[model samples]
Target: MKKKQLSIIENLIWNSAGSFTYLICQWLLTWIIVVHSKDLGNAGNLALAISITNIFFNLACFNIRPYLVSDLKQCYRSEQYSAFRLFTCLASLILCLIYTCMFGYTMDQIICVMLYMVFKLGEAWVDLLHGFEQRKMRMDIGGISLFIRGILSVLSFMAGVRFSGSVNTGIIFMTVCTWSFIFLYDMPQARKFEKIAPVFTKETIKKMLIEFLPLTIGGVLSSLGPSLPRQFLEAEQGSKVLGIYSTVATPAVFVQVAATYVFNPVLTEFASLYQRGEKRRFLKLLFKISFFLLAVSGASLVGGAVLGQWGLTFLYGKRIGAHADLFLPVIIFTCLNAMSWFLWSILIIFRELKALLVINVIGVIMCILIMFPLISKYGMQGVNDTLILYTCVLLVLMAVLVGRDIKCKFDR
Candidate 1:
């Protein structure tokens, strides 16, 4: 069998397209719901729900996909990785359910949140398959699955909400779309690389979990750091303002997704370089990537400043567009946050899990302490300001830690 291969440009296109498609669909779906229902509050609630669910999903993921993808030693079989992902997905669902129930939401909110969980779970399963695809250099499969899933899920969501006038119904349709794609597309493609079966050795699972614990904790905190603003807005100003804030801030996600997709295909090469003592080449490539991310951030901020309001109105609706001015600063920090994420990836490449944990913990704590006060004083704009401050501090800390680690490891 010929091994699948793609150049950097090809990898960038497929991965970025797929990710962009999903995010656009999600953003569009939120817009559609908000517009059609004439209920900004519901939109905000959904945003908060999805945001919290994403935190859980990231926690469940524990940054394992990349850890699995970068397994140059082939220490574990595909089945074992798959089993861990499945276990985490189940655990995430269980924990999310418990948290939701304990908070005591209305019946509608509970149903909507649970359905979103189902949708996210299915997406998580596909992401595990993507790790296999990425390892095999078959990112085309990952691209195709994400693109198709995004299209179908959003379309189903639109149809459900448009016809039935219910967000819960729309979410259910989205879940169905995920399951259909997972079984029909992702699972079969994954099997072509290796068999798909659960492997549960107690000791092996425990060891893998322990090894990945720091990264996992870091992933959760990293997600929570940004989520603090949305959670606060939802609590303090109510869902309508949150909805507007969410929509205005949503487009910035593209910058982060693009950076990740662009960098992903080269991760294996970084690991190989490190393994072969090509420290100079590794560090050179790392700096180049970081510089590219900075360029991307700069471009995004300029673009947002120019087209922020218009773009928001075009994608969402006029109601949401009123807050579009917030896009500029929000996107600036988003780019910074994206760069910080890239730096964390460097730490992961070096397996510096403790540093990753420390960086993210401090970031989250800073965000929390300042978030409430800012949101209270400045309203929606304050949330954006708080994020910018948090990301700046976080980015500096990560850059310093990662740079020191590289020097210690490769300075000769």
Candidate 2:
């Protein structure tokens, strides 16, 4: 039987469902850990641990997913990409182990961190599969896979945390769920598109890494910029404060993910339009997408301001709900972040990795300059302020980069 390719709307729906489920699972898992754990400190430590691990994971993956999907010229086979991903994942796990030890965490904290890293590793692998599916315009398969993983992992996590009251146990259960979904569903689906065979070559790997190094650096800095506030909070205010911030920030993830779900289906079209010299159409589409994102973000900010406290209280209990004031700034940051992310997608089409790296570096510098002082003055509210400032800087920098690239292209 011939497989049906997804239309743009169908693709968006599937991707949105998948992203929505992932966000829900993320929020639920944090809620479980924070609400049910014996020690409240565990919530903050777990959040910090995940933040650190994600940075290393980006290093390991070397920003390869976008590179893979944008390989419209078919320079490398799916198996080759898989091989590269495997190499990087192993490296990332080793780094996670080393980094975890340096943190001087307690035994249980170490165990939870390691288990979480393993879980993230599984997700990264599945992401590579998603890249293949996306390149084939079969993002529905990737979306379905994410939805399944999210549901199963959340269920297993809830049961584990409830039974043992241990974040480590929950993480282990979630890891198993992730790996199970990957091997059983994700791999087979990817295989249906292209045969699986390990292809490892030093030359190809080295060349790919060199070519994409700027993007990898940009990705690393991107993660670092957002995380600086959490790091500062953990050090200056301790884990409890950081945990509170993490909980409050969870809603923002939905905005970022929703933007991706809406805009990503058309990413490949951006490249195609530009390459074919359909400059008018490309610019028109870009403007429309940007405006749509701004409008959605505006709506979210207003809605969050009005209902955030009640909604968070309803979902995560009163403890988390108390920080209702943090919701507005966080939502504002989310809107800016969503717009910045959309701009990054446009820049990706132009292969503006170096410009992105410079922009990300500027954002990080802004974060460093403001995060400590704001946190020192305003406490948890200060961290949100830092992030908002960082997001604004990124939005402006990315916009400038996009404009410069477009000007250069048309002038040539």
Candidate 3:
């Protein structure tokens, strides 16, 4: 295919694959918790623990995952196949061990962490596969992987019709299967890296590791930023309210998930444009999309939520909608926040990665200051208010950073 044709296909694949994966993970987790636990308190506890595990897995992958994607893209173009695989395997093993004993971990936490880390290793290969797909712009196969995961997750739910262990086990099995396929998908493309393979050395690996820091720290802190408020709420208002809060958070979470899928390929393209020194296109796309992102994603959510707040019913079910009123501010901000991703997306593309690390730190700190006190007094609403406040702070900071980035170009 020609270059433009290839671009379209790749975007198609990347977006579709991401949507499939997000839906699978969302429904699977949602049902597993609902069916397994009886009360909101127990369900919220389980959700909280599982969420920490998910974050821990993300941290576990942080060491080299992003670097692997970035470097693997370069290696594929440069024909350094063997070296790429060697680095991938090395990075995977290192991550597996780091998660094993790294944190101030408990014995049980350690076991679950290990199970989760294994999941990350599998996921790392998936990233490598995505890197390959993006290199060739062959998104179809990547979409295939997501479809497979989604199918397995749905089957898991259906199997719960007859068997009790169906939910978690099916989810695990789906995770294992998805990663295994991704690893297989990556191996064939490793051939493209053959020529540059021998030049790969310790120095090269170290450089990649260093480059990984900005995104890794940002991803971790960014992951924790929204989460910490809920932790405060749990500590103060307790788990029942937290569960209700999380349930009502569905729309925001789902939209964010969809945004992520669309954002990934655009991010890769953005990074490439930056590398190619295409400043004008980057800024234009950044502004246009950022405006639309906020308008479309924020509007329906804020409005639907206001009505739902005053009313007593849920479009999905009353159970999950009970605490919808308490999270209105959160519902609105989360929409705005989802759109706000446009800033970080550009940051990723611009390679102003340290911006991510620094800003998310400020965001987390701000969340602590704003939410912790309010959480004890007002419950989930307090948590919601804190999120809104931090978002405003971050929004202004992002605007300043983006404006500076633009001005720097003119100065040059």
Candidate 4:
């Protein structure tokens, strides 16, 4: 039986629902640690695990999903992408272990980091599968998989933590549950579209690695932009402080996630518009998306101002609520990050890989230059400030590059 293809609106709804549920579940893990365990340090440990693994997650993913979906010409086979992803995933896992050891983390932290990396590995693999479904315009299947995985993993984690009283145990449960979903649900759904046998040929693998290397490096640097601050905070102030910062910064992620949900469904459309020389319509769509991002940012700021502290208190406890000042800056940083991501998508559609790499490199350089001084002087607030600066610079540089590309190609 052939499955029906979804309209863009249906895709958006399903994707949004699935992503929102997954993100909310992820957020709740931190909340569960704080409220159930009554330990900010546990939350911090989890946060640190997440911070470290995210860099490697980017490495493994190599920002390929967007490239895959937007490959209008079908330049690469699904099997080749799968094979390449398998290689990256193994490399990321090994490198994660090396990175964790080099940082001289305690055994417990190392264990936690490894467990979380395994969990994130599951996500990375499933993300490739989602790309397959998305390329077929069946994001609904991907969304359903995400929704189910989210529910199951969170429940399993909560139960494990509740019963065992250890975050690592919960993560183990989460990891197991996630991979189960991948084997049972996601793989099946993706196989409906095509056979996902991994194909490894030297020529194809080398070509893919060479072509996507810039995006891979940019992804690592971009991940570092936000992560360096958390890493610094953990080194200087310890896990409790990082926990508070991670908790306070959690809500702001919705801005970026929401922005992604808005733009991702229309990415193919944007490509189509540009490829067809529909310049006016492309610009109009771009402006609409920008306006929507701005509106969402404003709403987030207002909400942060009005209910940020109280809400943090209500959710995670007063320890986190006390850092309400971080809320506004975090929201701004997230908004900027979201805008930068939108610009990145635009540049990707334009196939301006060098510009994308250069912009992210500059942002990362800015992060390294200012991260220490900011952290040394301002404490956690400095972390927020550093990220804001890095993302702000990225947003500006990318905007300029995107503008130049548009002028050259669209404006005539």
Candidate 5:
């Protein structure tokens, strides 16, 4: 029996529902910690753990999902990608542990960071499965898996924190529940479409590492670009303030998450269009997505301006709401960052890995040079200012790259 394939609209709907549910659950977890817990430092600790683990997560996944989906030529088998992913995930875990140990974090913070990394490690594994599902154009399956796992993880975390009153316990519950979903649900669903066993090959692994080295480095630097500012904020201002910033900035992140929901389902289409030399259709699709993202970003800015303080106060309490002045800059930062990533998808589709690396390297350098001074001077506002500046620089460079690539395609 042949399975009926979903239309693009169907795929988009599923992907958006799943991704939005998962992201909102994450946001809500932070909100739960803030509203229920007596100590604000718990939120701060979790925020710090997330900021640190995000970079490591990029390292573990090595930006491979996009590459996996865009491999229209099927240069490598799913097993090969799986093998490499396992290797990277293991290596990234070890590095994460070493980093947490070496950093001056206290024992509790170290435990918190390591626990969060465990959860992320599970996510990275499931992500590989999702990549396989996406390549089969069965994103609906992956979306369902994400929805289930997201719900289980959030509920478990909520229960754990409510009972134990510790963020670490909450993360432990989230990790266990999430991994259970992966083994019992995600892997089984993935196996229905393709083989889940990883086939190890020395030559293929080496080839992928070399080919993807630029992207791996670029991914780390891209994560670092935002993380450096948070690190500076925490250093200068303290965890409570960092927690407040994280809470305040949470709503702004919806803009970026929304952008991903729009573009991710169409990534395969982008590759197919470009590969088939349907340049006109490709450009039309690209412009349409970009315009939609801009429209959403504009709407978000307006909404933030109108009800930003009240919403923050309602969700996170008056302490966090007091910093509502940072709302606009945070929204602008997220919007610019989201647009930068939209351009990033184009570069990934074009396989402009070297250019991506160069752009990220310059962005990270700019971030380092300005982050400390800005955070030290303006405090939380300085952190937002630095991010805004960093993402602006990134957006401009990426636009130039995408433009040059498009012009060359048209000229030819």
Candidate 6:
């Protein structure tokens, strides 16, 4: 029992450390890029290329990631991981190639996209690692992977950029190095629980593919919210606009990184527990934590945005700082949107696919609309307002659905 208590403390500390490292590294990298590349167009293009490549990565990996976490754990535990992994790799590689094809770009963009794939293939494995680790009842392996990325990112930033080529090269190279480490070490550690099954059958792949269908669509639509819109804004608005948005939006990443730290492991654990018939305890515990964290993070979003406004004004001159007001609402709405996301996580756990569909569908519709109209009229600030409205609606919807779910679950 004492051991259990200590383990929990260690997990929380490592998790917090991991998130803090991510924020520091991100802030430092952004500052360097901003200082060196005042050409908003080039910086925006870089940001856009990164966005494009990541979106492609997310598209290819999609639901399969979480699918592996829940599904592959069965393979690992049953000692069937050899066949399971073979089929998983074939499927992932095929999808990666397919996603690569979908990226239409100049040679430079293509090169960046390919490099991103190599790095992503490694980094994205974190999803699978988290699943396997938590199934063994230890979340630290995944936490360490995150800490490693944070450390490398900081190291790369501290090394500083003597040239544009160097910074650009460092970005992908450092990521590749870190992710390779994760892919190498973490997979074997996770495989300790892996059960090598005899048959890697056609039916298994078909089943995995079928299960991924809804999630795939939902994911593509979801990725568009952050990734695609930014690119669109960069194209229509400009890189300076992208940089400013990124700067203002930086604090939200802190909230997200921290939220993800706790949320990802819990989501995996909850999915596993639900499968094992601990549904009642699972929902009760989830509801409490979900509500508390959502609220805390939601408040933090507001505080962060307010500070972001001041931070921007000071960092950039008044001319640039005037744009800070445009960003504050985006931060607020993004936080609220994040709260609804916690609720969605519960919905996903219960395989409430239909509800999940409705939620993402509605949120996407609002976001899409916000993209066209406000972007035309008010530029960044308009996008910020519409996002706030979008998240507000999302939270309202979440409250209604959660209230309904709670009442129905206990109606008897």
Range of the 10 consecutive residues with the lowest summed lDDT in candidate 6: 1-10
How many clashing residue pairs appear in each of the predictions shown?
0, 0, 4, 0, 0, 9
lDDT of each: 0.82, 0.82, 0.59, 0.89, 0.89, 0.60
lDDT of 5: 0.89
* Candidate 6 lDDT by residue in tens digits, 278-391: 757777777766776767666775675557657766765454566666655665656675676676666665565556557667878878877777777777776666666766
Residue-by-residue lDDT tens digits, candidate 2, 1-412: 6487778788878888887888788778887787676565878877977888778778777776665666788788777787888888898888778877886767776777778888888888888888778777888988888888889888998888777877778888888878987899889888888755669999988987787788888988888888778887787888888888888888777887788888887787777787787878988999988888988888898889889999889877888899999988988888888888788878877888888888998889889998878999999899889999899889988888888878888557
Q: How far is candidate 6 from the true structure (C-alpha RMSD, Å)?
A: 4.2
Q: What tens digits encode model 4's per-residue C-alpha lDDT throughout 20-87?
A: 88888888888788888766889899999999999999999988887888888889988998999999
Candidate 1 regions exceeding 4 Å error are: none
Q: Poorest 10 consecutive residues of model 5 by lDDT?
A: 1-10
Q: Which stretches of candidate 4 lie over 4 Å from their true place?
A: none
Local accuracy of candidate 1 as per-residue lDDT tens digits, 242-271: 888887877788887788877787887787
Over 4 Å off, model 2:
none
**lDDT value for model 3:** 0.59
After TM-score superposition, the amount by which residue 15's alpha carbon in candidate 4 deviates from its true location, in angstroms, is 0.5
Which TM-score value belongs to model 2?
Answer: 0.95
The digit string of per-residue lDDT tens for model 5 on 227-299 reads 9899778878788899988989988898888898888888989989988888899889999999999999999
Q: Cα deviation in Å at residue 236, candidate 1?
A: 0.8
lDDT of 4 at 130: 90
TM-score of each: 0.96, 0.95, 0.78, 0.98, 0.98, 0.80
On TM-score, who's better, 1 or 5?
5
